[model samples]
Target chain A: MSAPAVAYPDHLRARVDDYLRTLRFPSRAPRTDGLEDAMRYSLLAGGKRIRPVLALATAEAAGVDAPDVLALAASLELIHTYSLIHDDLPAMDDDDLRRGRPTCHVKFGEDVAILAGDALYAEAFQHLLTAQPGEPARLLAAARELAAATGVDGMVGGQFLDVAGVSDTPEDLRRLHALKTGRLIGASVVCVLLLAGVDDEAVVRWRGFAGELGVLFQIVDDILDVTGTDEGLGKPQGSDERHGKRTYVTEYGLQGARSMAAECHRAARDTLSVVAPAGATELEQITDFIFTRTS
Target chain B: MSAPAVAYPDHLRARVDDYLRTLRFPSRAPRTDGLEDAMRYSLLAGGKRIRPVLALATAEAAGVDAPDVLALAASLELIHTYSLIHDDLPAMDDDDLRRGRPTCHVKFGEDVAILAGDALYAEAFQHLLTAQPGEPARLLAAARELAAATGVDGMVGGQFLDVAGVSDTPEDLRRLHALKTGRLIGASVVCVLLLAGVDDEAVVRWRGFAGELGVLFQIVDDILDVTGTDEGLGKPQGSDERHGKRTYVTEYGLQGARSMAAECHRAARDTLSVVAPAGATELEQITDFIFTRTS
Candidate 1:
């Protein structure tokens, strides 16, 4: 049985929503055309701004001002948005629905959609460079984290492996998830740690915690695809099974997958316990909330 | 008529060729998945290697050692290669031929091509970080320059404008080329200035000179696409015209475009005259070489 839904503090939820709103592209002149529209449509489409929220919340939990973390948070959102746009392309996942609306390609032409995604991905760094006046070193560090997590050795590499073939073992599923979904989510938390000037030991602990949390999140996502209604998922259900895509739950029986998820949550909690510095009550609450998300 | 072809210095040409060969990915075991083969194929499908050559030659002209500039030079090639891969994708330019060979997507499957391009782009930063043991700050600056040139306000943005409409006026075409092809090439020259630790005033002047040279180079390319023979051009001539793409040669007639190209080249030479320090004969050679290229 799952734990009851945790009531996220209203203030934090509102903050995330507001940030998402601010991320939309400013409207260009009438003749400027569909590129900006496609970018805004996908970026501003309602989804749980979880990754950016994690970055912001983690930074705040580490005692940095929330505004100081805003640009980094936005950069995370841009990376996430780019991935979604690309994944939904005709050459890739080719999905019609994303966040309960037509995907970027479905709404705009394929060529425009591709360019929009590329623009957003590039704009992420442009925004970072100009976002807030900070140490150039810190800004570069943030840019590196964003690039490394999204580029070849991170999410893209995992996608390649997933498309090529999955290893037959359950352990292979774990390793794949550790790269595909885990790295970027892990980077979100780590970005906050670096921004807050956390010690190396604490960063390691936080990254480990986030890694486990990411795996748990992926497993939960797989489970939801199998069991949840279309309305609940905001997209088609059973996509993993339909596509014959290898997933954690596919390798492990339902009961086994559930048990593994529980283990991951426990490991995550344990790692978080090690990393949470003094006065980290909010961080603890956020971890608890992660364990309770249903979709 | 174009100016007579100036003989390029034998040593510089040989060094560039050697650098290109050494930069090819080794087809060793554990990496024999054929992805490296695809990357190597594209990297070796030689164009002028203008960008990397500019980087290395500028550094040398600024009195920086060749060894210190190798990684930076190679990083520019990696970026150029990655951009070519994406530009040739079905959704983008859809060109079957690049540099007289089947484009990356034609030789490699689209999925592998996408991943290969991604790997090259990511490897660019990895190479910069690891290859040169120079000041970390310099490495970071180089990476940032590359990123800015490729990002939204740069090449990506220009591509966006290109695909979104041909409704652009002559002025819009100029702006688009400045970003699309000009930015990265400009960044290539700027990287050497920054790496050589040139004074701010000198760096500023070189950047302006490089930007003008890039625009001049692109305008000449547009003219060549329309006027040059298929044998000389490698790819089919007038492909851009067939696509209804608005180019300088499209907006202005052939004669007008040729005159504009010459004017741009002259302006570029003037800028270089102001920026190139004493004893920089190689820089003058590059200016002449740009004007004489048939393809």
Candidate 2:
């Protein structure tokens, strides 16, 4: 019977899309220059909304209602979207396709794309500060975590190392992914923990799970780059190798990388089993999906 | 006696520089990739430290000690520095020189420069959230104001309009500058008001003065771009005209722009006189310096 045919929380994603569609700018320019349109172009473009989904799942696992942290969750997607826009710039990964459409820079021109990314970054913090439902301290703490994960020592630092050429050793590649992609993914969960006032013991366990999930996600991504087709991936396959960038698949053989991903998946599920075994069904499903996603 | 010698607030600038130099990252990657150095290279390169100085001066005018708001004040400079790095990119203004040295992209490569700018943007919020001294509500308010001013309707929107080619009319030019340079400059003062718990009446007055000061600063900058030398301005003069960009001098003519700057200076001083007559000596001096600055 196909295991009763459950779904991956498209309802939560729809809620996010609704809130984002109705987002009202506190101020706007008298002259229109397509900045807002450009921002919404990539932001509203279809993706899995994985970061925000992670945030909502973390909230659910912690026994908080999803709507209570919806804005916080959506803010992660803003940061993620901004990173994608900037990453696709000609000077960076230089890809022309995202989500089966022209990349932000390709569609809107480079200057607008850069500004759109920047505006989204600023909007992420603004929306978190203004729209989140929490006490001031909790909100501030969440903002701090988001900023730290997005900053120099996190995603930006990781990208720098990647562009500058890491040594392709497992350690360097791990560090690169941990910074470039892992920190923000970890933050998506940790931010919910901060907002929900989760206890420290569970927080630590969740942190471990989040770290493992991040590694797992990156490893699966690397594997799919080798195995997936362009139509399935929504981007050109093997572009990573073309750019001479290091990945887990490059550092370790494909089978080796898949083994590592499976190990991480195991560690994550085990950690979750100990922490929120009763409430983390969605988190478990999401983990399985991330590990096995074809795209 | 040559009018008792006094200087601009080099002491406050020194304080900001010291705080910035000692900033500690909460997390870091195992590999170093020149991102930190790129951020520092642009941030520490001197440009009169006007934005932070404005913040500190606002704090002083409100009868608050500068050290209490030093981190908040310095955060503005970080945002300003990030904007400059991004603005000087080859896809943007395409400038190679800034503050009498190679631009961030020229010094650190384009990819590193982009990441450095991104890192600085993230760092600005992180520093404000973690390092700024205030109650949670107050700090959150300051952060919201900062983020709003730096986002789409503010600096980023203004830059978008500028790059996309405004109509070069006086209204369009005014709107562009108001968004691009004016919003963040205004936020520098208003952030202090929020942090210090200043009343609404005084906040409105300060906002007006800040608006005038921003216009004055941009007018003087436009004048200098037309009139100053490479050595004096620390960047190539006439580059705006060479790029076919419109400025205050282009829209209003040199004499007309100068007159407008003088009017703004007078309006700013008048606004300050009504609100902070006794405590705003530094504010008055800075206003004069901005109106008359050669660079």
Which residue ranges in model 2 land beyond 4 Å of their true spot? A1-7, A24-26, B1-7, B24-27
Best-performing candidate as measured by DockQ: 2
Model 1 segments more than 4 A misplaced: A23-33, A277-279, B1-3, B9-37, B129-142, B197-200
**How does chain B score by TM in each prediction?**
0.93, 0.95
TM accuracy, model 1:
0.91
TM-score of chain A of 2: 0.95
lDDT at B285, model 1: 74
Interface RMSD of 2: 1.8
Every model's DockQ: 0.37, 0.72
Tens digits of per-residue lDDT, candidate 1, A24-116, equal: 442122233456678778888866677877777787777788778888777778778887887777777778988788889888888777767
